[model samples]
Target: MTVTASIDIASSPEAVRAKFLDFASLPKYHKGFFASLTPLGPVEPENKIRVVFSSGQKMYAPIEHNTPTSFAWTGSIPLLFTGGTKFTQEEVFSGALSFLMGENAVARKFGFPEKTKKGWEGYNNDLKAWCEAK
Candidate 1:
């Protein structure tokens, strides 16, 4: 299943980039999903980071990119699914920001695609509010 969500923020891409890269603050803005984010090492492309969900599930994904306008990570839940997710920031008219989130996943025979899509919607809405506040 693939899902995507996006929103426009009132901030510049540079400001959004800085906030996006601050892995430690993820839980603060993304209240429900992330319980904590811990860096495994230095922040760089391909470095691993641990994401502990509020549900207590842990996932480790490698940084696919750390550029000013884009970032991504690829990870999997063993025996269930595997996927990659990315965030992109683009400058729009009047200095507004467009933030997009996309995910592509290949799931096993048992998977809940509908539920995932709904969750993405909520996440994106929350992200929009967070970025716009900055």
Candidate 2:
């Protein structure tokens, strides 16, 4: 299943890009949803990053940044009772920024599709507020 969320920020695309690249500061706005975001190493197309959820579940993914335009990552969570779920998340910045999320059938079966869409909408709202404030 695939879902997307988008918002227009009262800031330039360049400003939003700069803020987005500062991965370390993500938790400042996302703290309620994510426990923490840690970079495994330097930023690169395939750089691995660790994302810890508030529930203590950990996920890892290779991140790709397309300069002042977009970034994306694919990751998964192991579900002992039902195999696992694979997901691809992308963020694109134009005059606005959009969040796209895609998950496998297994994930959809477990209701991840709708949850992810709502989650992205909330996250993007916070992101828009942050960017506009700067």
The numbered model that scores best in lDDT is 2
For model 1, how does the per-residue alpha-carbon lDDT over 90-130 read when each residue is reduced to its tens digit?
21212121112223243322243444445445555665567
- Candidate 2 off by > 4 Å: 76-110
Give the best candidate by TM-score: 2
* Cα-based lDDT at residue 79, candidate 1: 11
lDDT of all predictions? 0.52, 0.55
- Pairs in steric clash, model 1: none
How far out, in Å, is residue 19 in model 2?
1.3
lDDT by residue (tens digit), candidate 2, 1-134: 23555556666666666665577788777655456667788756678778786768788868654443545555532111111211123333223212222344555566655665566666667666777783
Positional deviation of 109 in candidate 1, in angstroms? 11
Worst 10 residues of 2 by lDDT: 78-87
